[model samples]
Target: MVSKKQRLASVDALRGFDMFWIIGGEALFLPLFALTGWSVFHFGHGQMQHTQWHGFSFYDLIFPLFIFLSGVTLGLANKSLRGLPVSDRAPVYRKAVKRLFLLILLGVVYNHGWGSGIPADLGEVRYASVLARIGFAWFFAAMIVWHCTLRTQSVIAVTILLGYWLLQTLFGNLTPEGSVNAWVDQHVLPGITYQNRAYDPEGVLSTIPAIANALGGVFAGRWLAHHSGDHKAILKGLFMAATVSLLAGFLWHWVYPVNKELWTSSFVLITCGCCLLLLGIFYLVVDVWHWKRFTYIFSVIGCNAILVYLGTSLVNWQYSSKSLFGGIAAALPQQAAGTFLIACGVILLQWLVLRFLYKRGIFISP
Candidate 1:
C-alpha cells in the first residue's frame, strides 16, 4: 500500500493540474487562436467558454473534476479514521466543517473582489458558484463517509441521482419556451435566482447531480485506499467508469440534454467518466510505471492549489507583468501580443507562488 504521504503527492499533482486550466486555460489558448485567425464565431459564444443551457464543454469539466478529486483526497486522508475512537473522529469532523465554510467564504470574496476594475458589489455578487458547490458537496460527501459504510454511501449516491431526475421531470415547471431549465431555476431556488436574473451555475436543482460527482470520487477514493497495490483494481475502476459514462450519456440525452450548466445527470456521468479515465492513466503511468520526475511539476502546483487560486483571484498579477511585458505587447500591432503576455505573466506568477509555498512548506487545504 502507498503511504499517506505518497498519496498526497498524486492528489496534489492532480489538483494543481486541474487549477492550471481554471486559472488561465482560455487565456493561454486565445492567443494561439488569434494567431491562427480562427473564426471567433464559434469561439466567442459562451457555449465555447461555458456551457449553454444544457451541454458539456472542456471548461465545465474543470470545477466538477476538482470536486471529485477532493472527494478522492478526503477518502485517502481519512482512511484511518475508521480505526479511531469517536472522540478522535469528532475533531476531524469539526475541522472538515470549518474548512468547508472557509472555502465558501473565500469563494465569495474571490467573486466579489480581487481588485479587478469591475466594481465591487457584494449584494449583486453571486452567492452560489463553482467553489460554493464544491464546498457543499465536499461537506456533504464527507459527512456521508464519516457516518455510513462505503456500500451504504454508494447506494445513497445512486438514489440521489435517480430521485433528482424524477423530481426535475415531474415536479419542475416548464419555461415559456417549454423548457425545464428556467422553471427549475426559478422555482427550485425560490428567491435566490441567478445572479443577473440569467442563470445560476450552482443552482439548487443542479446540486443534486453535483453531489453524485463528489460521491463518485468518494467511491474511487475508497477503492484506492483498500486496493492501492492491486493492479487489477485500477483496471476495473477504469472499465466501470467508462461503461457508466457511455450508458448515462446515451440514456439521459433523451431527457436532460447532457447540459453542463444544468449539470444534468448525463453531464455528471460523462465528466466523471473522463475524470476516471484520466486518473487511471495517471495511476498507470506514475504509480505502476513509476514516472516520477515529470509528474513533479504538476504535483507542485497541486500541492498549493488553494493558495495559488486565491492569490490569482485577489491579486492582478497582470499588472506586475504589464510593467515589464506589457510594454513589449504594446510594440505588437494586434491584441495577440497583449493576450500572450498576460497569459505568460499569469503562468509565471502562479509558478512563483507555488515555488514559494513549496519552499516555505505552506499549503492551504479545504
Candidate 2:
C-alpha cells in the first residue's frame, strides 16, 4: 500500500520515457547502425518512423501514449474534483481551460506565430497540431470525470468510439487525401493544414475517438486510484484491463483498421492496451520492486516534461552540437554513425539542462 503523499514514480517515468523519444529519441536509432553495421536494422528504423499512410508504427504510439498519461495524471491529481461543489469547481475548470488555451497558443506559435490558424498569401497556417490534440482530449476527458461517475464515463467512452466507427463506415472513406476526415478539414479548416495535405491527420472529426483514448486512460487512472495502496490489486487490474482492450482492439481492427491518421477506434483500444502494459511494467520495476535507479534519468525528464518539450524547440541543440561534431560526422565510416554523434551531443545537452533543473528540484507543471 502506498501513502497519500507518495507520488507514483511509474507515471513520471513513463511520461519522461515518452518525452525522451519525442525530442531526439529517433536520432539515436539512426546512429546505432554505426555500431552493429546491420543494414537490416534499417527495417527497425522504419518502424520508428511513422507508417506513412494506412498502418500503425512505433512513432504513432508516442503522441497517444502521452495523451493517455495526461488522463492518468488528471485522474490521479484531480480525484478531489469528483466531490467538489459546483461553484467551487469553477476555478479548477478555469485552470483546465487556461491550459487548453495556452497549449493552443503555443501550438500556433510553434506552427507560425501570430499569423497561424489563418490563410496566408503563400503557405496556409496549420491550426491543427500535436499539442492541440492533447489539449482537446484532456479538456473533454477532464470534464467527463468532473461530472460523471466512473461507470457513466465508461459509457460515454464507448458511445464515442461506436459513434465514430459508424460515422466513418457509413460515410468516411478512411483514406489519406480523399477520406471523410479530409472532407471535414477542407470544409472546416479550408487551406489551413500540415504541409498542404488534403486533410489534417489531427483534424476535427477524428477528435471524437481521440477523446475515447484519453477516457480509456481515465478508466485506467480511476482503477489505479481505486486500488491505491493495494499493489497486488493494482497490478492484477491493470493486466486484466489491458488484455481485454488488446483483444478488443485487434478484433475491431479487422473492420475499422487501426489507423493513427484517422484515430480509428481500434487504434485507440490497441494504443491504450499498450499504454496499460507499459504502466504495468514501470510500476512493477520502479514502484513495486523499488528499482528507482533504473528510471532516475527518465524521471528527471518526466518531472519537467513541459520544460524540455518547449525548450528543445528553442534550444537548437542540434545546430550547436554540429559546431563541434561536424568533423566527427565527416570522419565517420557511415553517415548514420556521424548522425549518431551529433544526436548524442544534442541529447546530452538537453539532458544536462534537465539534470541541472532536476538537481535544483525545479519542476514545471501545468
Candidate 3:
C-alpha cells in the first residue's frame, strides 16, 4: 500500500499546482504577456480569460480539473470509510455533507456576501461559478461513493454522462435560433428561466455533466487506492484513463462540442483525461522519483488553499504595496512598476498566511 506520506505529498503537490494559476496567473502572467507587446485580446491568452458565450480555453479547464481532483480525494476518503465499522460510516458521511455545504456557502459568500460590497442582485452575482459547481459536484459524488461499491459507482458515472447527452440532444427546447446549450439551459435549471438574451455562467443544465467529471475522478481514486504501492499498476491505470477519456471526449465532441461552459460529457472526458495525465506526471516524479523539495512551496499553498483564496479575495493586499512600495516604484517612474510591486506584496502576504497556517498545523479542506 502507498504510505500516508506518499499520498499526502501527491495530493498537496497537485493541489498546489492547481492554485498557482489562480494566485499568479491573472495578476502576473497575463500582464507579463501584455508587457511583451502581446495584445490582451489578440491571441489565445485572451481566449484563455473566458469565451464570450461558448467555447473553451486553458483557463476554463482549471475549475473542472480541480473538481475532478476533489472526486479523486472523495474516492480515497470513501475507501477509508469503508474499512471502518458500520457505526462509524454515518458520522463520516455527515462530515462529508457538512464540508460540501460549507464549500457551497463559501462560494456564494465569496461572490455575493455583503462583505465583498458587491450588489446583492442575484442576476449580477456570480451564483453559478466554478467553486459552487465543485461544491455541488463534490457533494453528489460523495453521496454516490459513500453508498455504492466501486463497480456500482462506475455504472452510475457512465449512466449520468450518457443520460445527460440524450436529454440535451433529444428533449431540449429549441432556442429562438435553435441552439443546444441555450435550449438545455432554459429547460433544465430551476429557480431561473433560461433566456437567449444572456448567458448564465452557473446555468442549471451544466451541473449534470459536471458531476460526471467528478465521477471520473472517483474512478481514478478507487483504482489508485486499490493498486496502492504498485507503480506499474498505477501508471497503467492512468494511461487507460487518459486514453479512454480522450477518445470518448473526441467522439462526443463531434455532436456536442467540447465546451467548458456546457460542461458537456465530451468536455468532462477531455478535461479529466488532461487531469489524469497531469496527475500521472506528478505521481511519477514526486511519488516514484521522490523529487520532494521543489514541491514544498506549492504544498504550503495547497495545504491551506481555501484560506489563501479567501484571504486574497477579502483583504486588499495591494494597499500594502501602494502604501509601502508604491512610493519607491513611483520614484523610478516605471509605469508597470507599481503593478508589479503590488503583485509582489500580494504574493508575499499569501505566502506568509500559508506559512503561518502550516506552522500551526491548521489545514483547511473543502
Better of 2 and 3 by TM-score: 2
What order do candidates take by TM-score, descending? 2, 1, 3
* lDDT for each candidate structure: 0.71, 0.81, 0.71
Question: In candidate 1, which residue pairs get closer than 3 Å at backbone N, Cα or C atoms, i.e. clash?
Answer: 12-302, 13-299, 16-302, 54-259, 55-259, 55-260
Q: Give the TM-score of candidate 2.
A: 0.91
Which model is ahead, 1 or 3, in terms of TM-score?
A: 1
Candidate number of the best lDDT: 2
Point out where model 3 deviates above 4 Å: 1-6, 34-44, 78-87, 114-127, 173-199, 331-334
For model 2, how does the per-residue alpha-carbon lDDT over 88-108 read when each residue is reduced to its tens digit?
A: 888877888999988876676
Q: Write the per-residue lDDT of candidate 3 for residues 27-104, one digit (tens) a residue.
A: 665445545666653464564585443456667777887788888876665554556787888787777677777876
- Top-TM-score structure, candidate number: 2
Evaluated at residue 208, the lDDT of candidate 2 is 75
Over 1-366, each residue of candidate 1 has an lDDT whose tens digit, in order, gives: 235463744555677778777566557666767777666633743333776556667777778888889788767754446667889888878887888788878777767532333665344455566677888888888778777787888799889877876766775532323446556665555334454454466776677778888888877776777776887886687668767876777677777667776676777788888788777777776677776874776777887777777776788777877776887788888787677877788787778768778878887676
Instruction: Give lDDT for model 2.
Output: 0.81
